[model samples]
Target chain A: MNKNINHLVNETLDSFAHLQKVAAPDGLNERILQRMNQPKGSKEVYLFRNAQWLIAALVIGIVCNVYLAISYNNKGESNGTETSTISSFESHFRLETTTNLYE
Target chain B: MSELQLIAELKDGNQQAFIKLIDLYKHLVFNTVLNMVQQFEEAEDLTQEVFIQVFQSIQHFRGDSKLSTWLYRIAITKCLDWQRKNNAKKRMNSMKSIFGLDGHQDIIPDFVHPGIQLANKEKATMLFKALKQLPENQRIAFTLIKADGLSYEEVSEIMQTSIKSLEGLMHRAKENLRKSLEQFYKS
Candidate 1:
């Protein structure tokens, strides 16, 4: 049995013993050269990809700042108008009361 | 030009020298990788990758061994890495299926090595299936010896193992392959 196994194993492996070296596919050398000649880092691609996001973020931030500034100014103007209206009404009421009291 | 001159030229960014280097060793590297990976397209890609790596890192090669030995080392390492990544992907797919995340199908290795003779194709395929079941080192040693036709001493340098240990590995590999083949024939 052992001898049979050895014979079988040898026979099987012997088939592979003289495997003709397979030629590389056409254009393999060209492909390797192309890859080697490529620019090393994806720095340019990375910058291009992030450039869109960076611009979007900057625009968002600027818009938010502008909106907040406009809203704040509007609030301040409304508050001032309210205070002036209240003061004018108070002054008119006081003058009417004083005039009525005097009469 | 001498290999040393080629090395120097490659280090100096000489493209022609680089092409010469690739032309010289393309078959050796491709065949070694093909034997290991058992897939022509993947082997070709890996061969290109190995030369690209050599091209990029030629400056660090201190000439500790023959250039062929270094090339074999790089080729084998790339194959092993490819296998590991492939296995990991299989595992991930299996886990995904197990967790009901996705229905993942196993990758059937349809390796038809081009070098096998037409008469011996079936038997050689059986041997390759068995070879795939062997441990990585054993598989590598046996393939380097049987397929790449490297001597024990040369394989030792490429594998970074002593000759005795390489012999032991080869022996065990043969035993495992025999057992696998026996089972295969029985079934």
Candidate 2:
């Protein structure tokens, strides 16, 4: 049994001996050449081909920019209001705007 | 034509040069892919993809290694990619099965390589199954060495490994393959 098993292992390992090289399928060269000549789309062309995605991305970017601008304007208005309110508080309390406590 | 001249023509997109290139190396690429993929139709497709990639990227060929070595590298890479994709599909199918979906499980049939000797077909089939069970690097090294008939130096160049490292991989592969075959035969 040991010898038989050893024989099987060696045979299996050497099974590739005298292997023949198989040729590629018929007309594969022609098919490959045809594919090669298929006019590959350039990166710019690919981007153009997915113009919808590009448009969607542009729309999203514009929307984000508008949202940010609106938020900034609102923040600026609120800051102005706060400055006016502080000014009013200081005047009412007769407080100087630039009091130097450290001095 | 000389390899350098052919490469230059291929880089220039010369149709005749490309045809000559295919004629020169198609068998090597095809046999390497066929042994790895074990399916004739798929190997043929992958072989075409390899040459197409070679044509497209020939300009980048720096002539650091031989053209055949570069071709081997490209063919092996494509085969590995195909195997990874198939494995992922198998994983997906199994996941679907677990979810009780109608997953058509892919049963990989026993592969009999057409190039094997007539008397060694059965043994070769068993060996192939065992080869599949090996780690990816071991299997690649072994396949390139044995089935693809590449010398250690050639395979090392293609694999980008030292010949000593390749020898280690080959040794481990044979050891594991022997164990697998022994168990298979005993059963």
Candidate 3:
């Protein structure tokens, strides 16, 4: 009987411990509510709204670099062609002058 | 709001609905967390996180089980995750420092202070300490059954186990608590 009474006391004590005495912190509910009221970030928002400017900047930079590289390569090729033409013209003139003198 | 309504609003990012859910179930979550974490403030934070997860994953609820049961599972998993991630070793070390042995039963003063102020609250503190000593699953089962007043079937569903398995868990939990109490009262 004594053991049974003691068990009851302990059970009561344990159950009381489980009772919630602590309250949730103030304004935390409001804070969670506010976050919910705000729109969640969507995929479209991520693509166009969040990272669009950075992506656009990267694309523009790459295009400009490619255009510059292609134009520079073409300019070098054209310059080489002009140099070869001038050299060939000078050689022809030299050959004609030599042939005339010999004759 | 009803649990179903909370689930609907949570899926839609309705924060007030979430607040209402928390207000309704915070005690249950906090009690479970307090058993797992033991620290009061940390338990409260974990309780909030459990609700956040419920909000984030409300769509997955499927309504196959009671919302309370599902939330109980989520709360328990969150506690385990937080423990494994944040403070597993620190907790063990702190326990060692306090008890002078790894996993020794705690000995709060037994005199009872001749009716201490807020005696219920003081005993509650001791109960929390005793709860910390229980094995992981036993603690979970015991808290879900005793603290939340969940039916055995509900507990089985929340734990994702058979009813027979929950009975075994509850039996073992009771035995473990009895043994721990014997040790606590002896000192």
Scored by TM-score, the top model is 2
**Residue pairs of candidate 3 with colliding backbone atoms:** none
TM-score of chain A of 1: 0.37
Off by over 4 Å in 3: A1-22, A33-103, B1-6, B91-123
Full candidate order by TM-score, most accurate first: 2, 1, 3
Q: Write the per-residue lDDT of candidate 2 for residues B89-145, one digit (tens) a residue.
A: 999989999999987896779889887888999988888889889998999999999
* lDDT score of residue A62 within candidate 1: 95
Candidate 1: Cα lDDT at B170: 95
Name the docking class for model 1: acceptable
iRMSD in angstroms, per model: 1.7, 0.9, 5.7
Give the Å shift of residue B177 in candidate 3: 2.0
Tens digit of lDDT per residue, candidate 3, span A1-103?
Answer: 5586467547644654335434555665665555545777888877887587898999999999777666655554666643343454555578789999999
* lDDT for each residue of candidate 1 in B1-187, tens digit (9 for 90 to 100): 9988888898898989989999999999999999999888889999999999998789999988988999999999999999999999888988889999985876667676788788877778878888899999999999999888899999999999999999999999998988888776556
**Candidate 1 residue-wise lDDT, A1-103, digit = tens:** 7677667667886768757788888898899988877876588888988898999999999999777666655554666643343454565578789999999
lDDT of 3 by residue, B10-85 (tens): 7897767777787787766776676567666667677767877788788788998878778788989988788676
Task: Look at candidate 3 and tell me the lDDT of residue A52.
Answer: 79
Worst 10 residues of 1 chain B by lDDT: B103-112
Q: Which pairs of residues collide in candidate 1?
A: none
How far does residue A5 in candidate 3 sit from its true spot (Å)? 11
